[model samples]
Target: MSKKFFEERGDQSAVKAEIIQKYFATWANIILPTAQRYGGGKIAYIDLYAGPGRYKDGAASTPLLVLQKAIENPSLSGALVALFNDMDVNNTQTLQSEIDALLGIEKLKYKPEVNCNAVDHDAEEYFATTKLIPSFTFLDPFGYKGLSLRLVNGVIKDWGCDCVFFFNYNRISLGISNPMVQSHMAALFGDDRAAELRKNVEGVKPALREQMILEELTQALTEMGGKFVLPFRFRNDKGRLTHHLVFVSKSFKGYATMKGIMASASSKADQGVASFAYSPADSSMPLLFELTRPLDDLEGLLKKEYAGRTVSMLDIYESHSVGRPYLSKNYKDVLKKLEDAGDVSVVDPDGKPRRSNSFADRLMVSFPKVKK
Candidate 1:
């Protein structure tokens, strides 16, 4: 971890913090209400590469923001286990000092634990035997020394657990072809898949190479029971793709929650749809014409899936929205458009018309039957 990164907080850094903060807040709220079903009335927030709590410019980082959120909520204060770890001893020491200075730290049942330890030390050794306490783990390792798929699977193996990691694509992409970093690549994508990934990306264009690597990694995670893996790309000032903030979880709700958060922080939106990326030069680019359309295609999907049947917007969204960029609002907007074209009717549960109003989650959308 470089101390210079904390010297001045950049835009991407700030966006990362905001995404974590917003997701953790929503995650805590959803978990606390139904905590008993998940585990033994406990939850955790783990930060493996926690840096100094505050930047030199006086902006707070994820470690501090998490503690502040814990302080604000009484339920979280009582049940949350805050775990901060760093490979660098200096970073952990500064984080401890910052935690101590946080107001009302003693009100929590479990005090925040700060440790200076190797993140991947015996990671997979005890992963299967030892069950974690339903944690949300954030791995922001410097470079790619300690990152491994096994470590990520360990963190998200337990019930109600999720993970968001910083993936340095630029470094990994460059290193994929190097024999010196073969062992490291194997640790990340597993030995067999890693070899395949390297072979597949060879002699390909830069864009296609990137896609191949991401697809290989996604397939690896999918085999480990991680169904929903979302990546938010970050591009440098020169329009070069840098890295991604990838969120992985087995739960659909967690996927949807993080998707909403990331969508808002995106640098550009095509019409009302978010690109789910941040680019330095994106805002300066002018929108000339429509290259793509909205969820009219979604209307076709809905009609094909539920012809002559009626379903609630919530059900429609939950059942079909996974693995797609379409948001809940996109469903509503598309449904409204369908109603106007007489393809579907939006109504309340009691069969009352809601066509003149906003289409809510609970509102029913009835699709008309098509002739054979």
Candidate 2:
């Protein structure tokens, strides 16, 4: 974590906190019952690069936010296992103090663990060796050094484990080219792929280069068994891409849940589709939604891809929504349009046209066969 970040609680920081806290509440609620019923009642919240619990202006950071939430929720008070680590001793000390001073902290069944430890190769080895419980890990390393694919894989290897990591675009975009950071880049994308990434990104436009780099990162994660990887972008006050908070999971439910959360926090949306980004620089601009629904493009994609197929709405959403910006609602809306225009048929279980007004996931959607 950067010291400059704690100078004041910026808008980006607030949005980041909102995204994490909001999702944690839902995540805990969904997993808590199952975890208590069968498995160990422990759901972990691991923050690998947790900073001091508060910004200089007295606004609470993530550790405090999480603790406060846990204190409020009776089910989570004893069931949640929190482990917060920071490389800086001062930060760990401060975080310990903050945790101690928090109201109702003593009521938590499992006390929060605060540690001063560097998140490095040794740390990665520990995570790989330890069997983590169902966890929502937040890996917000200061730089690209500790943000390796192995570390990510280690944390998310268990069932119900998911991760949201800070990807410093500015650091990585430049670091990929610097010989000094070659080892770090290799750790992130593997040796051969890192070389290829560097070679491919040379002299490309900034936008294209960013996309290519992210593609490589996404590819690396998927290869490591991270099937669902979602990115939420943050732009600086000047509209320059500064950072990305990437959510990675293997479950469709987690992916869908995050899409809704990220969509709500989006800076711009078009035709009910979310950009999944936060841009303070665009504060003066009005919402980017077009009055006319130009869902022809999405409709065309669905028509061509799913022609001659009959699938449930959930299946369609799970299969097509990942790696695309469209949400379940977006897909439902587009499918409704296609159905209205006679391009496709949506039906109930008995194969008749759907009668309900609600676009339920259980309904079957049948794309028309291609005309001869």
Candidate 3:
């Protein structure tokens, strides 16, 4: 196998890195504390393909950022295990040096009792042998080959483990036709069924074909027992699709936490599919502009499903929250609007019309009856 190359390159930070860092930081901030609060004393973070701790420009990489988050949060000062794995020896050494520097500092506040392990091993082999734990694994590979579907299934088969991976859409699409990598592609999708499906879409439009492949991969994850799968698309400076940050988790809470974080990072207010773009013009700044999708679209969807049906608030939120672009907060807002406009009736447990708009307290929602 080819040695990891990104760290060997002089320039470390790129537009794509900027976009990814924002989402990674957001996710860590939410998940770290939440995991500590509920995980009964132990929490873990595993970064497969962790790079050198900092970019040439001094921007902290994912490993350092995660460590910093743990250090900042006093509540998570319990047993926290952080495993940083990379196949490249230089990358692992660099990360360890950075950690050593942090340890040498005397005055850092809220230092979590971190059991840090830096390993120089292939991510696939590590996952195959390591005993699974309640952890958050970040699988950001340069390409699609190292992260197999079987490994991902094994990681998430138990509870309290969530995965965020870089799905290289451009690379995968370009390589799909190459015969040498066909075995890897088959392993990625967990079977030959997806390969057959891809073969059938030979002449489809480029955009549509990419979407189909994304759907197939996502389906494969869900079939491996993932309760929620979310994909956040990233575009490069020239408006070309780069990679998708795909998240998989068995918990609805994990799904909601990630969805909320992604929504907050988004610049759009429509609360439907969120996308982030990196532009050459704003190289130094965070690019989190929301693409405009009609709010009416969500309203229409809600109406179609909930109209004339009595659905509980939790059920409604759970059903529409994860895997979709919109947030549960947005869904609640739309339901409140429908209630106010006399289109849907929001009720309490006693079946009386709810006086407040809070859906958490409300028991059920009944759409307005159609006039004869």
- Give the alpha-carbon lDDT of every model: 0.84, 0.88, 0.65
Which is superior by lDDT, 1 or 2? 2
Preferred candidate (TM-score higher): 1 or 3: 1
Q: Write the per-residue lDDT of candidate 3 for residues 201-280, one digit (tens) a residue.
A: 68889778877888888888898787789876666554456677777888887787777666555433444545432234
Per-residue lDDT of 186-300 in model 1, one digit per residue for the tens?
A: 9889999888888888899988887888888888888877889998888876656889998999999999999999999998776577878887768665353235665666777
For candidate 1, the 10 contiguous residues with the lowest summed lDDT are 285-294
Model 3 error, position 187 (Å): 1.7
Order the candidates by lDDT, highest first. 2, 1, 3
Candidate 3 scores a C-alpha RMSD against the true structure in Å of: 5.1
240-301 in candidate 2: lDDT tens per residue?
78999999998889988988999899877767777788986556655432343446678888
**Which is the leading candidate under lDDT?**
2
Residue 155 lDDT in candidate 3 = 70
Runs in model 2 deviating more than 4 A are 285-294, 350-356
Candidate 3 lands at a TM-score of 0.80
Candidate 3, run of 10 with poorest lDDT: 112-121
Candidate 2 weakest lDDT stretch, 10 residues: 285-294
